[model samples]
Target: MKKILVIEDEEFVRENILELLDSEGLEVFGAENGRIGVDLAQQQQPDLILCDVMMPELDGYGVLTTLRQDSILATIPFIFLTAKAAKVDFRQGMELGADDYLTKPFTRAELLGAIASRLKKQEAVQEHYNTEIQQAKDRLSYLAHHDSLTELPNRLSLQELFKQVQPQDDNYQEVLAVLFVGLDRFSKINDNLGSDFGDSLLKAVAIRLKACVDDQDIVARINADQFTVILAKRNHKKDAADVAQSILTSISKIFVVAAQEVFITASIGLAFYRRDSIELQQLLSYAKKAMLQAKQQGGNQYQFYTATFHIISVDYLNLETSLRHALEREELVVYYQPQVDLKTGKISGAEALLRWHHPQRGIIKPDKFIPIAEETGLIIPIGEWVLQAACKQTKIWQDAGFHCLRVAVNLSGRQFSQIDLSQKILQILRETGFHPQHIDLELTESMLVSNTEVAIRRLKTLKSLGMQIAVDDFGTGYSSLSYLQEFPFDILKIDRCFVRNITANPHNAAITEAIIQIAKTLELKLIAEGVETEAELNFVCRHNCDLMQGYLFSEPVPPQEFEKLLFSGKNLQFSPKQDHEAKVR
Candidate 1:
């Protein structure tokens, strides 16, 4: 029910008005003076207010002016009930923001009709504003999930699409294929012509590519020079191969971009998974890797991704048993891989990688045992040890003159899930005498997706302590663009799979460049992993990548070797003349 407040100096007028409104089924309030009416309005926040024009300590004009100053009460519909109905009095009330004026001794119909008209108009205005707000929200959501140039579904949209098309039954065999198509040497077009031409070419390609697939099939532009398609149908092995060939042939034809005839070829990779279980991300990764292989084999072809599965042997029991003691015996060691700053071509920081040296096994990679440690809940302790060690090493280097160098240490999923993770790291920092600013913690994308609220809270706590955070192997997991926008990350590390052959293979180059653009747009630091050649270095530098790490600089090495490089003042020898000459001119 609507609420109405009546303010009049005369007891009869106020009481009679309240009784009439009450009989009309409205919750009613009455006050003998304007002062009491203001107090009641503040308390009850009435829908509409009726006041006497000339009476009481505070008259109708004063009350309306005062209430209009309040943000909450400013929009309330107000009507003045007055014995004086002169032209000047009506003008004064209207100028004070009154909704309507009801002369004294008026009919009951006049009072109720004024209130009804004001309330109806107010509701219509509110509905219009609400609709505008909803429309703006929808537009923002669409822009967040789509590519601006081609207006095609991007990585985040692709992830949501996968969820809808996922196989339902666990026991029934399902066949799904992911095809990654990369335009070979496509960057040459941008370099020779311009970005406008390149953008037009990509838009044209998006149109033709969509025409090649059925309505049920999914097609999306995953990167600048790459497109991904999903064939979510049973018995799709042969059909997958045919689709790849069709896309390759379709993309190779000439295109009229900017009224200029342009020709391009695509190298397609087909990865089909036929099993009772499904992993969409894994299939996409395989297709990308296979596309790189196709590009390596001279391009203009399609390659089927093949995998070798290893049978589980009984050796894991002993390995697990040995890992329990590995930490205690000091068999685990930390290695430092230099992260080179592309702007200065100098070592700016190092990522601390953990390694194990078993007496019988010689050396063991982290991938072989990290999963085991995670499964057994051993990663919490080991991860803490690594953080402490990395921090202490960073302090040592800082004392030795590399004052600006920071150390990045990876945090495992198990360690990050702990409730007191931030407290534990803060304690380690205090114990190691290391400043939180000089150490960076790296986390995988999967670790943050499970419990976003918890992850955001923990990340905020760590950030409050002045520590930097990075997202490691970014493209390897299904991280949405909104996720990146929500998380407080200082850096984004491109996965090796996206950085391989970035210079010669358009597939990797396109993904690598797109990641760089995202980092730039978000104002986050970027690090390209696995940049192994001068060509790769040039590719990233030409696009203004912030940092890079790979064998081209130095692999993850023992502390002694890393110290020697630090002492020797070894810096990357590179020149930016080739990349920046045009801009400089």
Candidate 2:
């Protein structure tokens, strides 16, 4: 039975309405005043409330306002019983949240009709609310199982699918291959290009990846730049290899995103389900290991999971974990390698090299963990720390009477591409009270070549700050000497590869000399790296290399040791001095 509340000041009228509602099969409640009506409404939480206009303690408008303010009783339909039916009186009740109204002497049929109509509409409003709630839940569920960007199955969904694919019978196992495809230098694209462009590219890559597999193959985006494929009924190793190669080719093709053509490559790693393990996580893990191995061996190829890959991957993962904590633990220290002017044999500047002093592992060279840092995007923060530390230390050295001491810090690809990079470096220099003119920022040719316009803009921004910019690792990338005229580079550092055997190897000597000659012709400063022998030193000095840093002069030493060298006035003694009266610094 429906419940109704009757709040009439007159006892006779209240009893009459209560009895009448009872006869109509409604379980009824009665109150003498508006105050009692509000109390009864909250206790009963009734479907509707009937209140009178005139009452001693509280009026009908007051009762309605109280009920409407309550979360529990707010939705109940409320009717005002008022003798006055003027427009102003009706407006007052309605404005106070009165749902419907009844005249002083209302008919039974009219009262019942109003109650029934409101109850029906309330049911409809509740139904609509429930539907909206269900839709929100459905959207959340879809997001949990799918990558929001590509709308591809996510890692969790892939694991669930793995469970369904696993057969119950111990002996009967389907021949399956789990492959993980990783995009090479995907981080570079994300760091250089905007995320919107990178997201568009990933979505395009997803479509191409799906096209590379059959209907039976399940594809998922398990990570930011990693896609996984589960091949069913393909047991042979060669079948998986062929699919991997196809995927590689498809990824390597030019991608047109946002009206721009982008070229990227992929490396794949696959593990046979039965050959590796029946477990899904194990298989995926094995595939990922091989994927890392392929990336370490220089990307754009496929590799099968080998026992050796697991060892290497574990080492990388552990080292990456340690590196993440190394900053907070104060294990990372900046080591300065003295870069000496070949002609004067006096220390010109020092290149700031990062070293990890792990408590358990002793001194860890950068090569062991720098790639891990680069791949994980840890280079940005670590690179910033190095800048701050280098600038502060160089400032200290200058204060100690070494006024001309210059400090050079390398910029990671991610750091170089950041839009606020110049501002950040400028802020650090200001905080450290270091002169921007005394600091040199070194970046690779590959970083500049990625987006020449952006590189030029950023370079000019840094240049405006009075800091020198050098293109490090010069000949290792695809950039030609024309890059010298294209970008605003103040110095070109010869890569260690060519400088290592410049005297012995004819090809290396030719390349090194050509770089030096072009840089000399362009009138840019030159620095030769990896000069470990007297012959290598003589060879670069013969070509008028302005500065050189290697084991021959000094290996990268701790700041304390470098400070000692500075205090002791250690200098390289070399002959065949070249006059630089015509050269501008």
Candidate 3:
């Protein structure tokens, strides 16, 4: 039952209010003075507090302030009942956090209505606080057992749950199934949205995922944008696959938040657990490796751990070990892909792409080891290196007579969240002696969507440095077109998928045209990526595309080769082979 505490020194008025509330189906607790009222409040933690501001022993302000100091009672709504009618008195009561103020000789209806409003407000406030507290607790609990971002069971949670399903000493036959789910564009979300909003979207995704699973199954957020599910001991691979599909389906559904709808997808990696020799971390590693393989094959899919995949994983582990050394050894090279002015066919700028020159592996692709770096937080250092390296190269290019050419470096959304990224970039540019206008930072759509405010602020700061900002993979994102104007971007790189079919597919052509038109309207440069054919090039050029980059112009070539191409002046070497070959670049 709802309870109300009434504190008034006047016997007649205090009793009258108590009787009125009592008759109105509420439990009324009366106190003769403010001191006793505060004591009763701490003890009862009543639904509401009604106190006369001018009471003896302790004034209403004193009682309210005292209770407000205690976190437990701070939120309990307080109403002031006083004979003082001056605006100053009312102002004082409000400043004390009084929910409402009732002057002396108030009507029963007016008093009752004020009391009712305070009670309702209190109820609403409590509900909101409870939800926030519960969310915080859940977040902490999730962090304890799972990856805070992915809402996947953490290493600890996995170990605890894995042990529960481990076959006993007597039974070697029992097997436990585990599936690791990874999002293809989860980092994109973080890269586009600031980390907080990225975390919010992830938490929301986690809730959806949890709702899709069975009560008996153990699912936890394990790693960044990775979910680990411990299926029942006897659950079949097909069953796990079905659940994974359900998870993908659920997350794929448009999530309408803050008046906008967003969509996301995940890739699953599955492995069975054996108590004989396999450890928790080993199983998890295997699962994640398999998931990476699945993502490599193309996301929105699943892969089961197999001996063949393990062989690849072993190689990848070796690569990861070598990657750290490669950074220290300065074996990581930056390749530049030229962006050409579509109308004049002039070399406008270049995107600085990273390549690992592994001593044993020859050349390593970004897709092969980038995820590992991101997962292990090596991306922070690698990204810093990329930024500084790109700036250094831009300075070198300027010294070598390419002064006007801009060098665009991709910034991982994670790098932007470091609180000083803008400053860091500016410092790098200053230290490297690169002209700020000759550098561009390519951020993905996900970074802008995840945290609009932070991303905007960071980008704005970067823009203030006179560096251009471009949104990479523009078409394939969750950001709304309405927010397009708010972000500090100078260019939009149309995703290759959209550009790939534009030549042959009318629908794709229309979408690409619309994108170009939007860019034109915004007075932003439009770069059509992944163009593989003359027909595609012609289509883009016909639309007056500002820039174009793909194999058609040049695959991301080494700096030496790129420089040679510049010296040799081979402007356009693109020759469309066949209509059938007109696929993804």
Cα lDDT tens digits, model 3, 455-527, are: 8888888888898899898755432446567887898888887787576677567567666665665788888
**lDDT of candidate 3 at residue 546, scale 0 to 100:** 78
The sequence of per-residue lDDT tens digits that candidate 2 reaches over residues 130-181 is 6754553344355447775688988767887877776677676456789999
Q: Rank all candidate structures by their lDDT, best first, as comma-separated numbers.
A: 2, 1, 3
Query: What are the per-model numbers of colliding residue pairs?
Result: 0, 0, 21
The candidate scoring highest on TM-score is 1
Please, what are the lDDT tens digits per residue for candidate 1 over residues 368-484?
Answer: 999899989988888999988898988998998999998999999888888888889889988999999877889998789878998999999989999899999886565445777
Which portions of model 2 show Cα errors greater than 4 Å? Answer: 23-27, 311-585
- The best candidate by lDDT is 2
TM-score of each: 0.56, 0.53, 0.49
Superposed by TM-score, candidate 2 places the C-alpha of residue 250 at a distance from the truth, in angstroms, of 2.2
- For each candidate, the alpha-carbon lDDT, in order, equals 0.83, 0.84, 0.77
Lowest summed lDDT over 10 consecutive residues: which window, candidate 2?
576-585
At residue 364, candidate 3 shows an lDDT of 85
Please give the lDDT score at residue 10 for candidate 3: 93
